[model samples]
Target: MNDDLKAAVLERCRRMEIPLVGVASTDRWEHPPFLPWMPEEFYPQSIFPEARSVIVVGLPIHLPVLETSPSIYYHELYKTVNTLLDQYTYRLASFLTDCGYPSVFVPRDGYGSIEVLRKNPVAFFSHRHAAYLAGLGTFGVNNTLLTPEYGPRVRFGSVFSAAALPPDPVLAEDLCTRCMLCVEACPAGALDERDYPEGLTDKAACAANSAELARRHISPCGICIRVCPVGEDRERYGRTTAAGDDDPRRRRAREHVRKYGGL
Candidate 1:
């Protein structure tokens, strides 16, 4: 394994102000970490034949902004984050290629639009799964990756590289508190009260909700992630309770933000 290369990658991420970065050997995909794993076609090596390692990076969603869900503010933030993820991964891939390791970046959201997602409800690549394998987080009941820093309130992007970089160990400790806040808050009734894999998301229902929100110019209904009490971000933002139970002043502020943003 290239320890020096891994150090250089870390330094680059630090310089870029990227908060989270992890590496995983492509072989991890061959060995199933959980049952009902994604098909072989979705693996990093399958997409890029020369890939020996996968690098995953995560960007956090601000809890305060996300609290104003189904609003134009959150929608714009979502788009901005996705754009940055794609750009960052592309830059990372180019950096690796310059070092003689051929690499390719995967788009943050591989689908054309919410309408396409409403029909298929699956992406060509799964960044959540990549983040899990890269040891950045673990799967939560809501079917999103939960990190100690940001819970499900984080977005991920990945790069496939030919360098045999040392891989980070998968997280052995589960970060989810099983509070069911996400399940209860899902506007689409898409989440269940069981653990992940067993409590897989109703992607079709979720996407349908997003489709309706799209018509209103908000596209993503982030209620589930917003209510999740898993991350230290909750403490950072001083959010003491779930969404609907907030103080009237704060509740009214969110309601007002929603009223003007969409159809």
Candidate 2:
């Protein structure tokens, strides 16, 4: 019955057009540092006493759209993806409830800001960690989850439920190329091109840069994600603005992103 339920959940996510879905058992979790907004009890089981599983789902941010990072095209698409994630996860949570399993869906981003993050340096929950545990991705030097299909150009949401589901294995192979393109591309010098959790990225620097971008109404500094060379689209997108800054291809891609109104 548990296996059947898990399969059903995966199928439902697929029906909802979610590109990636992976499960992590609550027992398999290890809590990260807590932020001020995070309650003293911060584990999955702590959030929902009966939570037995976490369903992590990924939404791909169109590669062409991300090529225009820190631009209006990418910024709006970013919000659209987040909205889709929140709505779909809410639907999944409701589906679980209908199946006799209560659930809670986590937002893609919430309570995160330059001021708040500077003080706390963490979010109440980390969906990137959830996605990592679910075998969907690994951490990159940019402090984002790197996936095989889209690198860091993906957004994620999580659903914690009482339904007991078999946990997926954590990915054994790392996906990042340790390319310093992201580190160099970072206008704010936020990232230190190391490796996963050990690679230190200055969250304050990142936050400040993002805030400055927001001041201009862009609201995001996606230099790191823009330059990653992971995933199938890497060759198509190229690794850095310097690689082909004036390439007619680059300009065409940006126009394409704008034409579509976003990804």
Candidate 3:
């Protein structure tokens, strides 16, 4: 019964244009074997109580669009993607409930504001960690999940369910180059590349910088995502897509530079 239901969910997700899907048992959380367990408040069990498994979904953000980070172009795309993810997760949860499997959707944008993060850097759930457990990717130096297909250019959301779905194997490979580009690229100097999976970020500093960028009406800096070299091979495929030649994003970026004398 669980296998059939899992298959149905994956089919539905595929029909909805979801590119990546994986499931993980909640048991992966541990101190020594895996990364330390998240605090009880942030666990899937905390949200769904009966969440035996998590269904992690990935939505790819166009690499070209992300390359325009800290610009209105990328900012708008970010918001749009978040909105879509929220709606998608909600619908998936509804689908599971209708099938008699209780489920809950963990939203994409967990932090309401930098102020909220300052109060408690943790959220009720973490989609990235869920993705990692689901074998979609592993942690990179920048703390972003670097997927094999898209690197850090993907956003994730998860649905926690009572169904005891068979778990996906966790990815064992490290995808990051450890080039320290993400550390150097961070405008806020919020990262140190000395550690791969450990907490190497100054979340407070990162949040403060983003908040200040908001005040200036500038798109918050995502230099780490902008300069990541993991998915550069996608450029070969991007160039092959003839339809992207006259990309409006490219046109807008060129105009911005020409008029403002800035990149």
Best by TM-score: 1
lDDT of each: 0.90, 0.79, 0.76
Mind giving the per-residue lDDT tens digits that candidate 2 earns over 198-233?
Answer: 667888888888777776776676778877778766
Off by more than 4 A, model 3: 30-37, 236-263
Model 1: per-residue lDDT, tens digit, 1-263? 99999999989889888999999999999999988899999999999999999999999998888988989989999999999999999999999999999999999989999888877888899999889999999998888999989988999999999999999999999988898888887889999998889889998899888889999898689888888888888888778876634678888888888888789
For each of the candidates, give the backbone clash count: 0, 0, 0
* Model 1 TM-score (2 dp): 0.97
TM-score winner, 1 or 3? 1
Colliding residue pairs in candidate 3: none
What's the TM-score of each model vs. the native? 0.97, 0.87, 0.87
Regions of candidate 2 where Cα sits further than 4 Å from its true position: 31-40, 235-246, 252-263
Candidate 1, superposed: residue stretches over 4 Å from native: none
lDDT of 3 by residue, 97-214 (tens): 8988889888886778767877777667789888988999888889888888877888899998888888888889889888777888788888986765475689888888877766
